[model samples]
Target: MKYRIGRVLISEGQLREKVKELGAQIREDYKGEKVIFVCVLKGAVIFFADLLREMGPEVDAQFDFLAISSYGASTVSSGIVKIQEDLSTDIHGENVIIVEDILDTGLSLSYISKLLRERAPKSLEICVLLDKEERRTQPVNVKYTGFKIPDEFVIGYGLDYAGHFRHLPSVHIAEPAE
Candidate 1:
């Protein structure tokens, strides 16, 4: 399969600034307490890395990675989520934040949230880099969103298609091959 960049939807500078802003907000929201940042792996790795860096020293942040898959080498979601990996540390009685790459159908987040809630976390919230509300089949309350984008197949900045385009610094719409 071949793909082209349709257009740059979010520039690197924009992502940087927004991440910093979100980090500041998170720090303020969870001040004087240790917060566990649960990064949804693979896609969210880039966003999670950059976001944590901007969080500064005041926020007592711990980190873990969870790998869940709803889309596998495809542009569309299968509407089913599978947990490929789970958190290493217990989140019980801790302020937990799930950091995701995108919130599309909300199926994955919904599943993850429900599963995590059962663990008795003191608090649980979601932070996504992108939200495609148009494609949402299930409702998800995102505490922090970097961008609200159209229902387009986006790739780059840790988003990918068939395991490609994850290295692009900016987010772009993936154009189908002619």
Candidate 2:
């Protein structure tokens, strides 16, 4: 499948380097803490996998995947957050990291953050693969960010357009239908 709009925004190599850097930073900041890496599912699988490998200093922590939904199969966000599957681990007294593909609109991520906070995690922060600065309507502080993206539809490396283009090696815009 060919791209509809722009070319690759962030190539695979570029993504790798950024993730490595973020991992190193995280390792330094939370060296001795009990870090629980919680990756958001579907869109963040690839980013999480790469990032987890990049993190330095062995952490005696746990890893879990949270499947959440704020958007349907369309490009537009519905703004309603829902939990398809919840985390099995109790977040009590744990430093948790919520990893995601992109931070746009901020509703979903912010809601998730607050929800997790209620579980009594010792600390919680966000780490996103891509940050669409222009699309952020609400303020969200992500501890780790891989790239700052333009306000364009992107797909690849676990992000998709109607469930397609996720297999692309790099990020690409979905060509508009004429």
TM per prediction: 0.97, 0.93
Which ranges in model 2 have alpha carbons more than 4 Å from their true place? 1-6
lDDT of 1 at 99: 98
Model 2 lDDT tens row, 87-114: 9998899899999999989988988888
The residue pairs in collision within model 1 are none
Positional deviation of residue 31's Cα in model 1 after best superposition, in angstroms: 1.4
Counted clashes in each candidate structure: 0, 3
Q: After best superposition, candidate 1 residue 154: deviation in angstroms? A: 0.4
Residue 61 of candidate 1: its Cα lDDT? Answer: 90
Query: What lDDT would each prediction earn against the true structure?
Result: 0.93, 0.84
Steric clash pairs (candidate 2): 4-174, 4-175, 5-175
Model 1, 69-100: lDDT tens digits are 88998789998899999999999999999999
